[model samples]
Target: MAKHSKKSTNLWSTPAAQVLRATDDTRVEEIDFSLTPGFDGTKADAQELLAERGQVLSALQEKLYANGRSGDLRSILLVLQGMDTAGKGGMVRHVIGLVDPQGVDLASFGVPTKEEREHHYLWRIRNELPGGGKIGVFDRSHYEDVLVVAVHDLVPRQVWEPRFDEINAFEKELVDEGTLVVKVALFVSPEEQRTRLQERLDRPDKYWKYNPGDVTERGFLPQYRLAYQRILDRTNTDYAPWHVIPADRKWYSRLAVTELLIDALERLDLDWPAADFDVEVEKQRLANS
Candidate 1:
């Protein structure tokens, strides 16, 4: 394969990751979920742009995979934490689906199984970490230990409270070893969530996608908001920062995530692995054969 040149710039003057990243002072209530921060284009424009960016993203991913195969220790872990109907699935299909499946490792964490429950909260998560040179995506993630567990009082305060620091340490260790953890929380307004849920009930084809528990979860939005605020304030670190993307507009969410993935891969500055054989000798041998 031919070597690809890294792109000097992206579509926006600033990368979407910087535009959407959460800070120590970030308040979930103050963010406008429907607003597209770094993009002024319409949905159609976004769709077109996403198609164009896909090619660049694909090339970079190939480089990452090739480097990994050649003994590079670096990898990426994209943690997506979002409420139901926040477009997590769509982002996966549109953005991640563009890359070579062999180069990506994806996991969707829901209710733990009997086997998963027997171990520590991060046990299942640890097993699913992506190997060197691959993109690992967690659809929902270990934060559920805090967000969902804390919201419903599934565990005592003493149990779930200490996980924030534990998670920070785990991520820092991963970073120190070579994993670039890109954590994202998708913010969707209640009104939009209701509309999306209702559409699932209204359409037969979408019925399979709907979950009854989503409604029950919707009722606890206030509590979830407070919990997420604390998560942003505490778990948002410089080494493994959180990018709170406004996910109300499906197209924008897809585009924003695509850019975020691009940024993560780009920072690696990977190149195609050098051929190990002598080119002239191999060429003469092949020609003679």
Candidate 2:
């Protein structure tokens, strides 16, 4: 748990990375996920911010893709964890949608199939990891073993408890291999979650998104709370930090994700890949043609 420097610049108001970052002293329970730290304007303001963040992300993603083309061998992964209706799908659609889909490898883990159950929890996850110079999104991801399984007692405590360290090691390996890991916990209040779930049930267009089992899972929030608490406590390392986003405001959640991701990409200090062949020769050949 190395200390991060105290940056004073407020990107949106409390600084993008500072207040959002989950560290040793970060009290997950104390955070007001519903609070809008800045941007007191109407919905239009939020939409404008979203567009700006999207453009910034698109530019950085192109740089990463070019870096990969030049054989730079670097990449990034975004792991999103949250309760149902926390807007994981929305984040993907709004943020990752702005980038080239080919460069983004999205792995949305669901209930394991019979064959998948035969393998280790991380086996499927390992198979979907992005190659160098690509972006990866783990929607739900291996964190299920700890959060979901731990909440339901699907596995014994001993079986799932050790996975915190295992996850840390796995993420560290990614970092050492030129993959930056960014983890996010989309925090939604119980009341807001209920409203979103109701909206799913109410709207015919959203009928497909509604899940009967989500109601069952709602009853286990207490257990899930403990599980998520441990997740932040154990795995919020310097190599891979966890961001707790307030998902109550869907606009803020989406914009903040795009902004934070852009911040991470900018920190990479990526550059345009050097031309592989003689640039002057190619220019002359094209000019002659």
Candidate number of the best TM-score = 1
TM-score of each: 0.95, 0.93
Q: For model 1, how does the per-residue alpha-carbon lDDT over 152-206 read when each residue is reduced to its tens digit?
A: 9999999999999999999999999999999989989999999999999999999
Q: What shift in Å separates residue 138 of candidate 2 from its native position after superposition? A: 0.9
Q: List the residue pairs that clash in candidate 2.
A: 74-133
lDDT, candidate 2, 1-289, per-residue tens: 1112222123356655666888787776777878765445446676876776676688888889889877887899999999999999998998889899978989999999998899999999999998877999999999999988888889999999899999999999989999989899998888999999999989999999999999998998888877888999999999999998888988888877876788788888988888789999999999999
- Cα lDDT, all candidates: 0.89, 0.84
List candidate 1 segments past 4 Å from native: 1-13
lDDT for model 1, on a 0 to 1 scale? 0.89
TM-score of candidate 1 versus the correct structure, residues matched by position? 0.95
Alpha carbon lDDT of residue 63, candidate 2? Answer: 88
